[model samples]
Target: MSQPDQAPDQAPDQAFDVIISGGGLVGLTLALALDQGGLKIAVIDRLAAEAVLEESFDGRAAAIGFAAYRMMETLGIAQHLGEVQPIEHILVSDGRIGTPGRQGGPSALTLHFDHRETGSGTEPLGWMIENRRNRLALDIQVATRPGITRFTQDEILDIQVEPGAVRAKLKSGTKITAPLLVGAEGRGSFVRKKAGIRTYGWGYDQTAIVTTVAMEQPHGGVAHEYFLPTGPFAILPLTGNRANIVWSEKTSRAKALLSLSPAALEAELARRFGDFLGKVTLDAPVWSWPLSLELAATWAKPRITLAGDAAHGIHPIAGQGLNLGLKDVAALAETLVEAKALGQDLGDLTVLERYAQWRRTDTMTLAISCDAFVRLFSNDIGPIRALRTLGLGLVDALGPARRFFASHAGGDVGDLPRLLRGESLSPALN
Candidate 1:
């Protein structure tokens, strides 16, 4: 088990190199990354430090893209998260839930992405690991690193960013100073909000109901994404004969579904699940998230910068939210480490803008793509449905295109950071 969160042996008045406002996955990873690169960090969050070290399961699991998985491995956290289920094959199809295929058989406009074709050298498309497992693993990892302090149950009331310093006033009446401030807080980031960074996003009329399901048959390491008029229904593989269900429906219908008796919910699951898994039963309580796409207007200003959900939040249709956050961790870590090597101030607007520039285009591209997918797939229009059915067939037939998309979905497409590439952190310093 990891030790409780505490500061280093330095003077109580000493300033830190960086202070992160949210100590969830991204914040913790950043602290680990920067401290490895020789920077002191302070992390503050509302979660109790003791509880964070336990084997807590949050009911939601994340799809770790292959690149992000490599980054985790490089950070020495991957090996500790036990029993990750790899996605060997992904099958996508368009079908109405209660509607059958043509000729009263089964719809066959299936699109597939095979992991073997990704040129990733035996790596699967990605791995599905529970959020709790990742959090637990990181909790242990952070306790062993020096100069990385975690202050749980602490809230920052306000932030003042000066030319080369950031002073954060906590509700507990503590004033912590650091050269740079980073917000890994969620979409409703208080720090980002205080910094006057506007956000633009819209809610889908849909909600996603998530839970684990046990079945009579093994999953065989395959993932399924079935597009319904309501939204995409994702069945991700887990160890043994279990899978995670991310089922989407209209907000009202979802609320009704969640409010039903256990038997009623089981019948509802059977209506969409078919006989593929065989004898499915709910293994846990159903959890839900209202679908939305939220993007920060600006990622950085002067001594402060935003990462993870603070910067952008998107639809989970592609399961890239956490992976994207990890990308931000890698990118910000690389940027700040290199900047320090050049004798640059980590909080300078010029330095911060470089990080923002490197990330803005990619984040927007993902946001737009998620919006397009939700719009195209979540509609009941007859013509659009027919076109999508045809598109699925066409995409399946195009081998090279399918392979490229698979790799892209696996987080192998654009400019990758050193961490994602499985390289050492700050090679010169090492």
Candidate 2:
């Protein structure tokens, strides 16, 4: 078995085939995947593993697509996801400005994506899971992998890629070397900076205010997206009658709105969200995050590679941020495993390039699509609004077009990795 690569001044430990930085969901999940692939791995993070595992399930939730759910299952983390709320259907509509259809005379056009009708049989397309639970599940899985060593409260200070190995130095005075280094450190990844890899993307002049609310009426397992003038207000179903809300608005407006008194904030929320959920009361602390779309100039350079938020960070308008990262983990792990099976070096440029090629097109497409959606639909103007509303109506009226859109939301688009296809990783031969 491989061992951890120690610093020059420290005692030698087991060197790892892969060294992963960051212990977030994406990072830990990738560590588990690599371990399952028979590669001894070490994962380092700035936060304690217990802290991640013991986090409370609150308003912060993720809309997990079917494919993502399947991957979690294969990783042995899905069963630990607490209180899952299946998304039985999704209702997409525009606010006030109605789309053309039916006898309602240009009322909001509702496009329902029912999983049962889409050849998914009795299974729902996806489920809503609290982010805390997702992180906890990953922590648990990583802890059980014998091939993986996890270090928390340790931050990476720098990375040095040599001819045949990559070295990682930690702020805690620890060091490790591996054939491959995976940067899953998040948007402001230090590994990316240490590698001198430039990034390309811009920030949307918006902030998403997230919180949960107790609604009087049941959501009936249906997620709702209301395209408002400022941005899309997503009401994702949570356990019971509670729904997680991600309301995007102009940064200036968000700042002012966040400063409003509790009573005033409730009033504003009710007005924007309408009476669909009846009386709504905030059930969690409001958290706001600036929206941005960031992509690395390159996913890999020699023995160092980027994954998840380290590679790409996009606006959460489509709720596909985590899913995209999970996709990266699956693809990268599979690429390395396949390379090993062919007696090729896992860190070879050819092998790593395949992984980068697999993700680039899809990543770029989603980034551009999300940016365009945010730009076009977030504005309230005479001609643009009318045109977009009409476009929504036209798309809703077309069945094939609607199915195509639904498939993407369901994570059924494009080539899927073996892990996403529900293939189990083989036991470590070593």
Candidate 3:
């Protein structure tokens, strides 16, 4: 093994069936998925695995949709997740900050999503696991898979896309080649940029303040979204008497709020948090992320392709960020596995376009919807507010409409890949 932060000088040039840049959650997931289907994968990441696996490295968590969760389970990665929380119900409401109820709670006008109504019977909407826990799980799974090799604390210095393969030179002086290269490195993807793909996006002028809180009372597996004038404040249930808070606010207000002392910050949080979950105390250091909506002009180019945030970065209003990326992994893996089985060139644009087409509409629709939600709900215009509130209530009352929304949130909409459908990615299953 190479020393920490240093690549082995004796490491010879390597080749893989697929080379994935940025071994983040999305990249690692793709590596494992393709590896399961008998593809040799090389995952190169700039950050060391040991550094990123630390608990303090990332305090954030993700809401893994049922379908994405199934993909992980299908890839044999779910068992390593230490512990997780299920979201049995979701409550959406529009209200001002000082509204009355359980001491400044949501208005009576609310949209409620019950897991039972989602047509899946007892299945929860999604599972919530801390980001570090997920990384740990991926690391554990990666270690056991001989087909997947990882190079950490290394970055692609340059990329060369040939007619038959994509070659990458690492900063550590290592050369790697693959039939296909995937950029899963979040917004500023090196692979996408090297492919000369353009992107279109805009900042929301909003920032999400995230932190975990210990609640005096159990959350009952319920998630809450309160639309205030500033932005949406979401309380996502976590295991044990705890919940994750995604409090979106104007960047200016978020900055000011974050600058406050711990007690002051908790006081502000308590006002929006209300007494629904009893007294809530911060259990972790707060983190803030600037919100934005970005989409690549295209997801594929010759020997190179993009997945996860590299392909599309959407607002987190719906908590579908990670799930969307996982969906990309499933689609791309299925496409590549089947193509390889057919003796087709994995780097061929024709084969990659299939993966792109399968994801284009789904990703675009979600991105637009999330942006719309952010705009529509982050306001107090009387008529608009009333209309949106009425809309929420209407959707909640109509069984069919409610179920459709619930099902969509559960990632059961549109055509699903084999991995998402809880099937093996083996081409034999095709």
lDDT of each: 0.84, 0.81, 0.89
Evaluate model 3: give its lDDT: 0.89
Candidate 3 residue runs with Cα over 4 Å from true position: 1-12, 100-102, 427-430
What stretches of model 2 exceed 4 Å from their correct place?
1-8, 53-59, 96-107, 116-121, 427-430
Flag the better candidate by lDDT, 1 or 3.
3
Candidate 2: tens digits of C-alpha lDDT, residues 1-430: 9988665557653478888888888888898787778788888889876665543433478888887778888878987776799988887766543323321111355666777533365668688988887887787677677888887899887777788888777777777888888889999998888889999988888999998889898889988887777888888889988889999998999999999988899887887666667888988888889999899999998888899999999988888898889889989998987787777877778788999999999889888899998888887787987788788888777878877777676666789887887786664532
Collision count of model 2: 5
TM-score of each: 0.93, 0.92, 0.96
In candidate 3, residue 422 scores what lDDT?
Answer: 89
lDDT of 2 at 69: 78
lDDT of 3 by residue, 1-430 (tens): 6665545455656989999999999999999999888999999999988998776777788989888998989888899996799888888998898764445566787888887765467778889988998998999999999999898999999998887888899888899999999999999998888889999999999999999999888889988889888999988988887888899999999999999998899899899887866787999989999999989999998899999999999988899999999999999999999898899999999999999999999999889999999999999999999899889989888989988887777788889898988899765565
lDDT of prediction 2: 0.81
For model 3, give the 10-residue run with minimal summed lDDT: 3-12
Error of 2 at 121 (Å): 4.2
